[model samples]
Target: MIKKITTDDLRKMQNKEGLILQGCGGDLQEWQDGINELLANENILLDGSKFENCLSFECNGITCLLFPFEENVKLDTGKLAIWRLRSHSTFGGTWLSDYVPNRLGGYLAEQQKPDCPLIGQDGNIFNLMGIASKTLRRNGMADQATEMCERITQTAGSYYEALNIIGEYVNITSAEDADIDEDQGMVM
Candidate 1:
């Protein structure tokens, strides 16, 4: 299916092999049809490629398309290039492999460290996630809390990985630290 994805979603993807058509403005449907027609004329459609095998997105106010190939398939870029140049906005095409997505770094830099009381709690991954989610929501970062939990559930493979994901969104305090803070509060 031609899924609509965001720039962040695109950045997170790995090993994507496709053609990216950018700078498509005005009627998106017309552009989609034109691409399908071009693919048909070039015998790409005869090779079992379909319109549903593409993805649509918007970058910098221009509509874009991603024609994903499951395996290594060479396409005649000459026709696509000419077709793009004839568009109203002068669309451009690029090999998906040319764009390198940063798997980490840029995303982690934006994370907030809300304090989460995880040390004294059950070591169950779900339990720790709950504590962290509540703490994040209390800190007015409910969206981030949800995203963090989703990442853990979707991508984390083991208990330690879940903890790592949780740590990305919150500061986990040890039981000893909590006790020390309480004791210091009483003395103060």
Candidate 2:
């Protein structure tokens, strides 16, 4: 079943998580406006301003933003048989400090990559790399954090692949033990 999230529920997730709005039933603009109104009714403002049907929100130190998404359904028939496939994909939501990377892009682009990380040949840190690096720094693993930054800046791959690799070194058992292994390095 689809679980409906309430404003109170969102408040509970403040600072701990952000919402990823998707699959609203409408055209693009209408969908965006729907989410904007839903959040506005909950007292969440777009960057603490009046509602302009924008995609990013800030309230009580919590941040929420919409990521780019695609939904595809396919049907194939061969040899008197038919096959159907349905898939949903979404990308580009990384928690960075008090906000997401590209709020403006959240309004304009199909893929919201405001400050998205560089991948493959670009060799720059973006998205999950930023999040993991931030997590490492907050945990007092400055050296490890530095190493993570360096590693991500030098690595090459898709966002999902890079996130999985970096995530290997970022296990958190508790507040006291973020469990970042120094010797393991940033690459898996």
Candidate 3:
């Protein structure tokens, strides 16, 4: 079974530092419950309909997007894996441009190559992927990303240096700022 992000972890993130992550793929209801509980104690940005239906809280303080759905999740080792454990899920993305921040993906834009993984997939791939993300194999079949990453680093040059950002996450368990601005709650 996948190790769902712990409630205590969520609480620690929001109250102490206002950092939370969303990986919107699997049972949204489960994630929904987690956020609703958090919502009862904090100010969150969520799509009313989607939040009510899937219960995703695109919290204001979220700064990372976890990506374990790639061909080899283990490729996310080292610096990147840490970010995955803490980043927001691309599930909340409204458009391609907004999905992956330029830093992580800027190299793709420059290369102008379609890096998509082996397509021709069948059913319920994303669902299985979510399960995998919760507790994926430490090492999967994909080649180590180190070499590719190094190549990217060399290529990104000045742009990568400029775009990289150290993000923040919150795990609030207190109700001190538990009021979701009635206005920001609009399902955007």
lDDT of 1 by residue, 5-86 (tens): 7555555455556667776667766767777777778665545554655677776676778777655444555665555456
Q: Give the TM-score of each candidate.
A: 0.46, 0.24, 0.19
lDDT of 2: 0.39
Predicted structure with the largest lDDT when compared to the true one:
1
Model 2 lDDT per residue over 98-151, tens place: 222333222212221122122322344365566666666665555556765665
Candidate 2's displacement at residue 79, Å, is 74
Q: Rank order by lDDT, top first?
A: 1, 2, 3
Off by over 4 Å in 1: 71-89, 100-188
**lDDT per model vs. reference:** 0.68, 0.39, 0.29
Q: What TM-score does structure 3 among the candidates reach? A: 0.19
Kindly indicate the candidate among 2 and 3 with the higher lDDT: 2
- In model 3, where is the ten-residue run with the lowest total lDDT? 165-174
Clashes of each: 0, 1, 16
TM-score winner, 2 or 3: 2
lDDT for 32 (candidate 3):
52
Off by over 4 Å in 3: 1-26, 43-50, 53-99, 102-188
